[model samples]
Target chain A: MGLKIIVLAKQVPDTRNVGKDAMKADGTVNRAALAAIFNPEDLNALEQALRLKDRYPGSEITILTMGPGRAADIIREGLYRGADKGYLLTDRAFAGSDTLATSYAIACAIRKIKHFDLIVAGRQAIDGDTAQVGPQVAEKLNLPQITYAETVKSAEGGKITVVRRLERGVETVEAPLPCVITVNASAPDCRPRNAKRVMKFKHAKTVTESQAQSEDYIDLTNDRPYLNIEEWSVNDIETDMKWLGLGGSPTKVKKIENVVFQAKESKRITNNEEELEAMIVELIENHTIG
Target chain B: MGNLFVICEIEEGKIADVSLELLTKGRSLANDLSCKLEAVVLGHQLKGIEKQVFPFGVDVLHLADSKDLEIYTTLPFTAVIVDLFKQEKPEICLLGATTLGRDLGPRISSALQSGLTADCTSLEIGDHEDKKAGKTYKNLLYQIRPAFGGNIVATIINPDCRPQMATVREGVMKMEVYNENHKGKVKTIDVDKLLKPEDLVVKVIERHMEKSKVNIKNSSIIVAGGYGMGSREGFNQLFQLAEVLSAEVGASRAAVDAGYADHERQIGQTGVTVRPKLYIACGISGQIQHTAGMEESAMVIAINNDSNAPINKIADYVINGEVNDIVAKLIKLYKKNSK
Candidate 1:
């Protein structure tokens, strides 16, 4: 039994640098203005997984992501950076899923890929910053999970050790095999793409993209296999249909509005000794100041 | 009766300060919803915990006593909470947004298939309208948190989920007054069968606490230098000002990332949220993330070379000058005033 390490990666819109056009008419995200990149923290997660493969020579590292078909760009980037395999879970049925529904789909895919030693995810996705899906998938799989892991101490003999970043300090702990660990930004920074590997897998395409390319019927490059991730539809996984999408999701977005913070007009009271005392008393009475 | 569940976390027998803060905050929410405030304590033979929780306003305390539960573990701790939530349907669940809370709250909430809001800065009771029933429900718990890189405050509510959950950062709420005569009931839970050696997959071999030369979080007077603190030598000047005031040193995210100071002393969204009585910003550009964390400080005095810096807009008093000159002047001023 060899070690099979899989990382859950997401290509999110560049939220840190959101511009005016980042919002649509409905106040939903206008993803067009946002350039998609491998989520910053997920890069850290992928680096850790790559390091694991580095330490244990024969271990296989696969990158798994769920997004639109355009997300294949991330898979190619993963391949260019030494992942042995890439799996993309994309379907129109998976749209409008929140963190819970997203986790259900990812967990189903993770379970389908049996005999995996460890799963790595970024502490939280930048888009929602919910920090729910990673741990949620771990719970669904019924595995012991370590979150905010700063470093992986060891992974051997059906056991894993890591240092979790705490508020005041860090706690070092070892968990049994088949555990889920969410890597924090404090994890060692990711390595740059391997140019040789990039040249080898740059032409890799998804099954749908490849089929589309075949219909166009023009071979652009003869470098590497057009590696398209096996896209699975709703019927691909064994899950309760009732618990899969909008039906299974118990929560819904009531509404999203631009929250503007504005300071209230202040009736400036003179800074006299008596006024200060009176203001303090009034503040205490109103429960605004302690 | 619906119980307001307060997940009280303790470190070394003494309940964590944030837990008390949560208890105080929970008291109002529980009262607003007409529910009983319950404290859920998990540790190894902890004694006198119920007595301490009284002033914080807990009515009942659920104690889970076990040696294995002494150290924090995701498996057993989460399992115990899940079972408790199932057995007791709490209307609102509160946890301190500490390291342990952030690590455990999401897992438990997800396992129960409920909504869990993290790092909430403000919370209150409001009216939520039911879409299906087309009626307004009064006294719905409102969980307000900073989002969009802390650009604005978004209000969140768990409409369908029975227990409205939120993990608030420490220092965001004030602790209640402590009274000696206060009292509450403590009940010990025996779940040895549910928790076993296999459940304890994670083991802490050795725990080391870092020695703090200057922990800004607890500091009363903090001299915080930001990106405008030109270089390492400039930060040292702020440190000197702190030393003269007998205060602690702090830095903005930019300064910390620029390697001017250690990350431990960072004060912002990605850093520690501080509410010191007096906060002095030296040459710091007031980014939203930094302002979001420190806006609650009692008195803010911003010293920036740029008179128009955003930090000045929110500052109670703004001193316009170079950080070096301002820090040097402040150090000299402190020495003169103290002497």
Candidate 2:
């Protein structure tokens, strides 16, 4: 039987290419200054979902993301890459959500969507680097989770085999289906965007984005229902206001320090054992080594 | 209400090293906050772990000995920790940022609705004032870590939630060995009632024992290369030097990205943190990301053309020259001296 796959993705500010304005005065990320790109490992997760769709024929892939209104761009990018449709869980109440609250809100939205046999996401987001969201969602939903997954080897008979890339090496383990899987960066690179798909999804927009459009596209959106991306707000999803946003986030930033390394006075040495021996002996004498 | 808890993850019937580090660090925090330090060990038949952990400054050693916890699975371990957390509203909780901790800590904190920090390099007890939130918290766990991928060091506080949870990187804190003659109370926790039948969703089908790979974090000697190495051939010279020095080969993220090395060999913030005895750099302009991984190396010797490279800041000795030239000369000298 073909499965229903939900690919969780995020449009994170490109932290890898951080510039001077990447951090704000409050030590938080400056989302406006840096270019926003799809979280790299999430693309790898998407590739796994697409591969599973190819094998399972009728399997559907839905890209789900929680961000500001602009994050619908991530869903359009996913559509061009092979996602069937997407849901953007955007709300003012969800702002400033830490991992715990973020997962809580997302879980509420997932309950609204209702049907999903599998959920796949990147092992960790580059910006947060916490790797907690996927498993936290699994826990909230009481589902089994496989983290650091390198590949999905097989999926048959209500079970899925996953190869994990651990600190030591690799592990091949099998788990029951309807479980969550977080993919690693070492997994196969995602395929390039197809030109035909890009042309087809170029006009895709969320209701908010469509409202800002000068062109009259309401009829086009109504004619091709896939062109409209689903956007949900706090009111749309059944969630407690106390468990959303800054009110719910327990972690607080006490302080932040800007650190820059300055070089110490380096000694010049010729390539010889006498010089090396002398340095080594001094290091030993200084208790730096034995 | 004012107690520090360290989850002592047991492996191969012994407390993991990171657990000891947390306990050692937690003891000072407990003293700072005028509280007691407790360590939790969960497994089937712990085999006299209390005697080993008591000396680490634990006032109360809690054990949850059950068949379900022989090998760590997230569900059972999370159930045990959260159940204990609900009963004993500990102010601060710490766990090693190991595979097991990373998997279990989030679930525990989520169930408790507490804040959980991951990969914290430093932890302290401090006062937290949030101007934006308009509140001040006293005696909070200030979890410090290199944020923005090691570019900035940020201090995070979970003042609003009880059991301010944090997962510490291994080897970040020094382990303490207190007087073993001292006695502490030991309490056994029952986990049978806390777990649900549906929580047993995952079963270990097969566990193939692969030959344990050499971990760079534990390597006594490391020869780390960087982007300046130019190509794979330049990395070969570093390998030769490592062969002579009997050191592990590590690479900065740049070299790993340049396709000269594999991701496993990467030494940096996003990669692996190492505390080698000696660290030798070749062609590596040390960024904070790379240095954060191995800055604790007992001795650092940097060889780079750019004398002003940031890596030279922490390096104990700096050699200015081409990496290939220096590596070859070092290899020859090492061989000759041993002979």
Over B152-212, each residue of candidate 1 has an lDDT whose tens digit, in order, gives: 4577777777677888876777788545576778777877977767677788876665654
Where does model 2 exceed 4 Å of error? A19-33, A268-290, B131-135, B209-212, B218-220, B254-266, B305-308, B333-339
Shift of residue B41 alpha carbon in model 2, Å: 1.8
**Candidate 2 structure quality by residue, lDDT tens digits, A1-290:** 78899999998877667676776777666768878889999999999999999999899999999999889998999999999999999988998899999999988888888898889999888777898899889888878888888889877788899888765556777778888899988899888888999999999999988888766786778889999999998988999999899888988776778766655556766555578667756755665443
Instruction: Kindly report which residue pairs in candidate 1 clash with one another.
Output: A205-A228, A206-A228
Which lDDT values do the candidates have, in the order given? 0.77, 0.83
The candidates' interface RMSDs, in order, read: 6.6, 3.3
lDDT by residue (tens digit), candidate 2, B163-191: 89999877677888866775689998877
Score chain A of each prediction against the true chain A by TM-score and list the results. 0.85, 0.89
Best by DockQ: 2
TM-score winner among the candidates?
Answer: 2
| Winner by lDDT | 2
**Model 1 C-alpha lDDT per residue in residues A1-290, reported as the tens digit of each score:** 35789998998877666666766766555668888989878888998898888888899988889999999888888888888888888877788676777888989999898879999999987766667778889988988888888899889989899988876677888888898989987788888889998876766777677777764433442333445456777777776765666556655544455533344233333323344345445533544333
